[model samples]
Target: MPHGFPIYPWLCLLFTYIRGLNSTVGESRMKSLLLKPRSCSRVLQGHPWVFAGEVQDLLPGSENGKTVVLRDSRKRILGSGVYNQNSKIIWRRYAWNKVPFSMQFIRKSIEKAIQRRPVETCRRLVWSESDLLPGLVVDQYGDALVVQALTLAIDMRLPAIATILQELTNAKAVVFRNDASVRKLEGLETYVGTFNDQVLEPLNLDIDGLSYQLDLLKGQKTGFYLDQREQHALVSTFAKGGAVLDAFCNQGAFALQCAKAGAKSVIGIDSSDTAVQLARYNAKENRLEATFEVENVFDYFTNNRDERFDLIVLDPPPFARSHAQVEGALKGYKEINLRAIKALNPGGILATYTCSQAFSMEVFEDLVSGAASDARRTIQILHHCYQAKDHPILLTMPESAYLHGLILEAD
Candidate 1:
């Protein structure tokens, strides 16, 4: 029997073993590996974002807006996401489950987001990653859909998303205001145009009993700050019988609300002459007693130090673009809040907000507190406000909670 043994059998066994070993090694190499452990911690901690530094080894070089699989060190699959090496957020996780990222996924996400709120005449249809579709936001204004593509990943998928919006909402037109500065971070150019059909004029919106005319083409953030709708209603409750000053007032949202709430007088100030004219027109359309001024908010505060008001709103744009600019932003916040606090009469109300994501809630509160202390005034917290329900914040991503407002009383 030993004599019948052949060398060919031994060679075959060796080849089979080597092949098996090679396959095992190849599979190990195929596992998605995050380069940085800290990045893995963030993802494992339920955050949906992964920075470029977090990846230990991306199997393939970062391709712009290409879907890639995510895996852990143990050779386990984590999820699927889009890769954008140019962005600080290199990976935007779309789903935790094994689902193909497709138009169907986007449509379902949009539908689910829309269902979260009661049927409103106007609302946000898609809130970026909050809806599990990162870098895309769609606001519904009656028959029109205003879209903002803020990232390369979303911009690449804009056509599919836009088609879904038009088909689902039966929108007369879809307008792409791809003018957000964040796009530049993803190496994308700015663009503004109408999709499907031309939006010839501003669209009229009736929101929470008040009517608003929006210039989808020329206006900011899809023609209005729909996220501030609830805050506007809250301010109206305290605006009655007072002289209200709306600084940085665009289109008279706060001013019109105050006037409609029976405020004795309303003064809206903005640096843009066009904005001032539009605000004045809005007040006139609503039959409200409101005045508009084309002056910079900071300049107005500097020139009129002795002016006093019963109620003042300081809703400024985001002062910080990155974490490094937070200190300068804080200084700016302190300056404006200090002036606004000093301008308020005794027992007056100050409705203030910071739309900066870099400015955390604690930092914003400290800034407000410091302003009150500098003005030698006592401040009482009335209420804390956030973006409306239409702009849903994802629990997994705390960064999505960008808007913060505080109603404070000065004594």
Candidate 2:
């Protein structure tokens, strides 16, 4: 309209702006992946992971932390995912369509994940791929939120995640517990940090009427095992007037709950001196009468042959982290179950759990059966437990359901 000023110069400027816009769009377009014939079957079945072997071709510039649109060999659209050339899991699907990897997407995903779980003082907000945000886990403890970024894509977006979480939850602090060994599988280095330059300290939280001091900075798996929150109360229901033993007890959650439930006696054992000391401190903080000892559970069982308990809880860390270690993990599970069965009084209860994703429930149950057979004890399955509701399991991905437990009665 300003023809008098300079019509030719204005037209030239408009053309240049259009070219720049097109260039930006081209640069931002998502890279794509073509999958092998049968590889698409798993993606079609709703699984979210695609290994390197499954990928037929990857577009140029499809590097780690880049989002890719996945397609089957037949050119059919499969989904969109984050590409990681450095990881065996080359692709982690986040949506069934081409989705932009942006702050809005991350914020919406986190919001939806939070909405899925019930409001609680402590709970898992985002559970890795189960919540459609692969390799990202967010756990809330009171006013603090602990996050873990296991994949390169998610790790790169940590600042965005922290900002979104802070905005949504109004949390006092957001701490990163990215020190899990599993991060190595994704080629991520381990380090811990906090959002907003806040200091990481031991947080005192009262969960289910039990007090706990959590060291989110240097503690185990985001300070506490929140996945077993439901199991704590469930196991405590059988503790009244009974002798209780919590093997591999970290911070004495189960033992403290058992003692609070009026158990005749409660003893918690762990190989970590720091854990035992913290457990003792937790017990004293709660004014609960329980014993904490720094000793290997296997050694405790072997040395205290005369010690029998009415209820025993075996919640050990994963003995198997990969498929190669499953056989050894099974043997370890069998030995623990067999020992617990032998150590139980007649009609006593045994609650055992395996956090290893490699061990399926069928495999776990079979091992427990073998243990009972070896111990020559009649075993009755009381309850089959899983991770708490907040840590939901995606039906299609078995790995999402890592924590599996079975309560039994041995006679």
Candidate 3:
């Protein structure tokens, strides 16, 4: 062997050749998904979803919860996405170029999402598609992080996600809140537990001087609703020196905020007895004077004809989860708004909200308008509200902007 004659150069050349050959072979064997000729525009416009009808064919060897190359009818490579044939959203693009859905990619995505928001004790660290992680949500509560995987792809990689979250947040506990109904679309089961099956005690959080004790295991929507943190402060501005009634008051957040703002009297109504009890506990913990009752808000509005309030807050849960429910949701909105308008004292303020993504701003505004008309009351829109900044909305995805509200003053 001629010592160091030209051996190093030859070896480098051979390695490069083999690497290129392996890359070509890997590309040929990767699963491919083709879209109809005209169906490529939406994906090109940066929208992540490719519906079932848009897909021309998912070539053989494709597997659910795995990455697949997307192509147009003309065989032009469009991008790469996670494929789930069982879901109406057949593909959800994660990259505009060929890339594997590997652990490193997931780690970088999760880290970038967490860095996008302010470092707060309690906040939404990641917001599903808005953060470029479709069907994934992470909420930080003190030292605990609650994660929800709503898609088969993310669900299959939960352990990796947990490890990455623990490393990034240094969280003492990581809980899974995977009970959302949307998981049914991906053919995934709904369940909740901690990472590594470790038990986590109830988490206590303090936001803007208010404290809350939440059971991340048994509570609703990742233990508590972090989206309304901004609205609680915004609505409290109008509560001073007035009687404030918080309807549909889950955990009595609005009622407590009002009491803290020095409202003359604060009353909260909720149908959930447990929620009412928690609300009462929260009021006592904060040393705020507020009354909580376990009664249906609708019935309370209907039966308490003579009751009135200077400020009425109606922050009901989502009424419409799908297009089919939009009609009935509108009716429900009108009924609740009508009763609230009637229950308001002259010149009272009504802070109403809808978390339903199916209802557009125009439709929601129209429903409120119809309610005011039927109740024969004139109102002025004083303020417009949306989810807190922590939950960023992707402009291209309308569904990301789910929570919207209006603060109105009745004359």
**Best TM-score among the predictions, by candidate number:** 2
Which ranges in model 2 have alpha carbons more than 4 Å from their true place?
1-28, 38-41, 59-62
107-211 per-residue lDDT for model 1 (tens digits): 788888777777777888888888888888888888888899887656656656677788888988888887788888887777677764464588667777767
Clashes of 1: 3
What's the TM-score of every candidate structure? 0.89, 0.92, 0.91
List per-candidate RMSD values in Å: 13.2, 9.1, 10.0
Model 3 segments more than 4 A misplaced: 1-29, 40-44, 59-62
- Give the per-residue lDDT digits (tens) of candidate 2, residues 120-166: 88889999888888899999999999999898777766666777898
lDDT of 2 at 295: 94
- lDDT of model 1, residue 361: 78
lDDT of 3: 0.84
lDDT of 3 at 346: 94
Please give the TM-score that candidate 2 achieves against the real structure. 0.92
Point out the higher-scoring one by TM-score: 1 or 2: 2
> Candidate 3 at 325: error in angstroms?
0.8
Using lDDT as the measure, which candidate wins? 2
| lDDT computed for candidate 2 | 0.86
